[model samples]
Target: MTKMMKAVVKSKKAKGAELQEVPVPECGAQEVLIKVKATSICGTDVHIYAWDEWSQSRVKPPYIFGHEFSGEVVETGDLVHNIQVGDHVSAETHIVCGHCAQCMTGNAHICQETQIIGVDRDGCFAEYISLPAQNIWKNDPSLSWDRASVQEPLGNAVHTVLAGEVSGKTVAVIGCGPIGLMAVSVAKASGASRIFAFDLNDYRLNLAEKMGATDTIHSMHADPLEVVRKETNNAGVDVVCEMSGHPVAMDQGFKMVTNGGRVSILSLPVRPVEIDVTNDIVFKGVTVQGITGRKMFQTWQQTAGLLSSGQVDVDPIITHHFDLADFEKGFNLMLKGECGKVVLHP
Candidate 1:
């Protein structure tokens, strides 16, 4: 008989998922079977749970769907080397096709045939998941499961905040989601002179404060552009890290950045957002970048170093934990935006 494990499955073409028994996946020749110890909720997971427009278009039902996780390798495939059972690990969630032009040119994060683990394949919201050995990132033995699980998202924060010069510069992080909060901590750890965090949610703003944001602004209650000018003395921020997918907030980021400033955008707006290219971009000479997943192994290396050296603390950001069976409670809190990173123990 095939081994069975309890997993939260998106069994319907609608909102919500079901706790069901799924057959343990077969480990491929280049893959390793991980006994998942901890997994975390991502904004993408929320979108899928809500069955939003993006989820509706991208996800297929009846599959396990989550990506951020840490586990011990329980089994290694026949062809696998350099990875062995008992290694504590998390993975780079993007599985890229190596022959693509982007992959060949050191930009595999934007590979033409990139497939996300949770979005394009069976994910980690289960007791066991098999992943390609090439993608495994070994964790420090002393790192907590929850913290290790979050390294994937933390890599995202590291990539966005460090993409440009941040040290001794005024910076703005426009979003207080978990990743946004991580960006705040990253900016502070990176020696940014001042960090402003903007969000409409008071709960998240508070979390941002604990994450090392020099100032937290409730965007709905105050004018972000006006405040940016007042704080920077009309020069505007030197760097803007855009994590809010809202068009209005994103536009404000563009406007609040100083001439020749760098704006690295990591958020995926649900639809195309219109912005004034002539004034906010061209004339001002703003450098706009569309950030995607972590930069393969480079981001992972930075993330591990930061976590291991105590350069950044993620304890405040990981605010909730639940058992695998209690996944619904975590999702409920995520939908309300009342909590930070929610980790699920399997």
Candidate 2:
């Protein structure tokens, strides 16, 4: 009989998930089976749990659904050489085809043939997960699982903040989600002159402050654009990291970026958003970057260095922890925006 493992399964085409015992995934010839040690709730996971429009269209029910995680390799396929059983690890959730044009060009992170773990297939929301060997990332054995599990999202923050020059430049992180909060810390560590964090949630804004935000703007209480203008002497911020996904906030980010500055967007907006192209892009000479996953492994190196060197401490941002069985509690806090990064221990 196949070994059974506990997993949070999206068993229906509805607004929640179920805890069930599922068969452990088999390690393929070029794959590894990891024993999940820690996992975290992502905004995408929340969407799947809530069965949002994106989830409805992209996710298939009766499957496991989580991606951000750290684990130990429990088994390795016959063809796997880089990783060995007993190695502590995490994975790049994206399984990209090696022969794709983007992959061949060293831009595999944006490979058109990318298949995400949680969204496109079985994910890490279980005790064990089988992953492609190429996607495995070795972790420092001494690193805490909570911190290790969050590296994926932190890489997003790093990639966005480091997309352009940040030293001595002012940055506005538009959105106070976990990734947004991490962006604030990354900006501070990268020597950004000022870091303005914007969000409607006071809870998240407070977390941003703890994460080293120079100023936290509760959009519900203040006009974000006006505040940015007032604080910057009407010149505007030098860089805007858009993680809000809200149309209004995204527009504000464009409007508040100084001419010739950069706007790096990491959030995925649910619907199409209209913008003043001439004012926001053309005449302003602003550079707009659509940031996706971490730069294949370059961003990973930066993120690991920052975390290991104490330049960027994520302890303050990871506000909660729960056993894997209590995942619902974690999701509830995430849904309410009342917590920072929530980690789950298996």
Highest lDDT: give the candidate number: 1
Model 1 sits at a Cα RMSD from the real structure of: 0.8
TM-score of candidate 1 against the unseen true structure: 0.99
Worst window of 10 by summed lDDT in candidate 2 = 53-62
- Candidate 1: misplaced stretches above 4 Å? none
> What local lDDT does model 1 show for residue 31?
97
Using Cα atoms with residue i matched to residue i, what is each candidate's TM-score against the true structure?
A: 0.99, 0.98
Q: Write the per-residue lDDT of candidate 2 for residues 1-346, one digit (tens) a residue.
A: 9999999999999998988999999999999999999999999999999998878988888899999999999899999988988998988888898898999999999999999989999998899999999898899999998899999999999999999999999999999999999999999999999999999898888899999998998898999989999999999999999998999999999999999999999998888888899989999999999998898899889999999999999999899999889999999999999899999887
Model 1 lowest lDDT segment of ten? 53-62
**Counted clashes in each candidate structure:** 0, 0
